[model samples]
Target chain A: MPNILVVEDSPTMRQLIGFAMKRIASSRVIEATDGIDALKKLSSEKIDLILADINMPVMDGLKLVSLVRSNPAYKDIPIIIITTEGAEEDKKRALAIGANAYLPKPIQTQELIKLVNSFISQ
Target chain B: MERETSIGKKADEFLQLFRKGEEFTHEILKENERLRFKLAQLEEAIERSGDEAKIRLYEERIKFTEDELNSLKERFRQVEEENKDFAAKYVEVEDENNNLANLYVASYQLHSTLDFNEVLRIVLEIVINLIGAEKFSVLLIEEKTNELIPVGAEGISISDVPKVRFGEGIIGTAAKEGESYFSENIHNLHNRGSISTETPIVCIPLKIKEHVIGVIAIYSLLLQKEKFSNVDYELFNLLAGHAATAIFSSRLYTQSERKLTTIQSFLDMLKEKPRR
Candidate 1:
């Protein structure tokens, strides 16, 4: 059972992502309003994977990815960036900064689940 | 003496005859031996031919089995490919199911509240999350002025949004005509940095039993949403019906509450009057 941390600022978007994550068998979803809340959750819970939105209010997804990569204790955790549809620069930067993969919005739930499952099973 | 010579010649002739008969019998025995050797060689050749026939039969059987095995392998490959195709199709159906579920939830949440502000918030949420609209406004028709005014919005301030008179522009026309309008060239109308109300991609009229109350104007979609999807259309239909009812109900409830408060205050003032 992998614990997935979803970091997004919009309440409805966060809820939608959380709803999609629930379909994954034996997976637990942890919600955070922004990157700062995500770090807080990371310090407390044994997070197996992270799904974060690129644009957020406090400390965006890229900053969180860089921070997680630089840290020794949580450096190995997989991060999947949830990018806007045509934001190629954000996708490239997220991957370059040690993000495992990306899922664009209007996200396909099956695709998101498959990507997570792959990372979790790794 | 002639009789003795003739008898001696006769004896010599008989001796020659006996020697010739012995030579004839030796020739016959040599011919019999040659025939026996030829018979043995023919029997050996027949045995070798029988063995070659059996070997040829076994080779044919092996070849047939090999063909069957290859055929089975080909069938297995096809079945595997078919299984892959089915798996992909199943995922597609599942994705579609999830999208429908989102629409259900959006509809459910809209009607779950009686607060006007809460209803507006739900509308905004549905547009952002389900419709993927980045900039939009909920404009209700003002009763006295006959103009559509922005009551709630996202990605644009309420003050920034201009009021549209009845049947004036795209939004006004949509509201006045009580019909939804979707832009044909939405792909080319994407603005990168700033938000604009000049060109709206979609305008859905909120109606209650053919009475148009307001309009949901979508100026631009999120950067990722290059085109509208089937599910988005479903969501718009849902919003047109459910959102309108929710907003109308909540506004009525608030108005009723205010009226009750006013009536209660009037009674209190009468009671506090100097025993008149």
Candidate 2:
């Protein structure tokens, strides 16, 4: 079972994703309110994967992704940027920053589950 | 930035050096005295009220400068408070969203029992509780009157909303234009004597398609003036859509029930045996 880290500024979004993931995945879900906090958790915890939201205060998810990819300890951990921003440029940037996947907000649960499974399988 | 700091330091050093130089310092003192003598000579005319217009002009200039200084001070205060409030909102939205308020709204929207008034009350609750507005109201659009009539309200006397109309007040203009407005400082603004305090008013237009449906108005006691976020717009629009759908559905339900009764009574009459 993969331990998933969920980073989002919105509680509703966190719950929506957490609930959906709980229903679908055999993983221990952890939460972080913002990118800085997310960074701390990624370092201290053994996180297998991540689901992060963009447009957060204190440090944004894009910066967080770059940070995570740069860190030697957490570099290989698959981070999927799950955000409301659905622009292609944002998607490309996320991937370019070493994000494993990108899912837009109000994420369809089934699709999210499929993506998670594919990531875990790989 | 460093150059600006260096310039300030150099100016302080220059003043110190000027004070150290006795000869140059005496010369500067004489120059100041000469300027003061000239200023006093010119000041005699206005001081004696030789020309009332000139005196009035000086008074007005003094008042204008004072007012400008006060305004700048207020602007500084507003900006500082605004930044603090922004930080607070960031904290709040993070914390409140943790409570699943969005899901609550979503589920609430799905419930058919909430009439327009009830829905508005709920919306008002969101505004007051979550958004931190001191006063909030949802005024429904009356097509007949072309006015936004108050449906649900908070932090206002009923006497305040005495038959408000379009083109009548600030709210009216906002509602009429179907545009959101945020007056950070409302001292110079008019509101038909409805709003008493010289506070900021944030008016959000509620519309569905081309028809303006309502207005969500809130008054800010804080320096925060951001009236509506994307989430707010989305939720307000969703709530409006919910209101419209629920209204149509309920009306249809009532019509069906009436028809069902009529059909039942007609069948009852048809079942009766005919007399020869």
Q: Largest TM-score belongs to which candidate?
A: 1
Find the candidate with the highest DockQ and give its number: 1
Write the residue-wise lDDT of candidate 1 on B119-237 in tens digits: 89989978876787878999999989999989999888889899999898899999989999988877754665775675687999999989999999988888778788788888898
lDDT of 2 by residue, B83-121 (tens): 999999976775455334454545354353534444444
DockQ of 2: 0.02
**Candidate 1 i-RMS (Å)?**
2.4
- Model 1 spans > 4 angstroms off: A54-63, A66-71, A83-86, A92-99, B1-31, B66-74, B77-81, B193-196, B257-276
Q: Summarize candidate 1's per-residue lDDT along A58-82 as a digit string, tens digits.
A: 7999999999999999999999988
lDDT of each: 0.87, 0.68
lDDT of 2: 0.68
TM-score (all chains, Cα) for each model: 0.82, 0.38
TM-score, candidate 1, is: 0.82
* Total colliding residue pairs, candidate 2: 3
- Each predicted complex: what DockQ? 0.51, 0.02
Clashes of each: 1, 3
Q: lDDT tens string, model 2, A1-122? A: 78889998765556566766775557878899999999888778889888888778899999999998888988988888876555688889889889989976545455677888778777
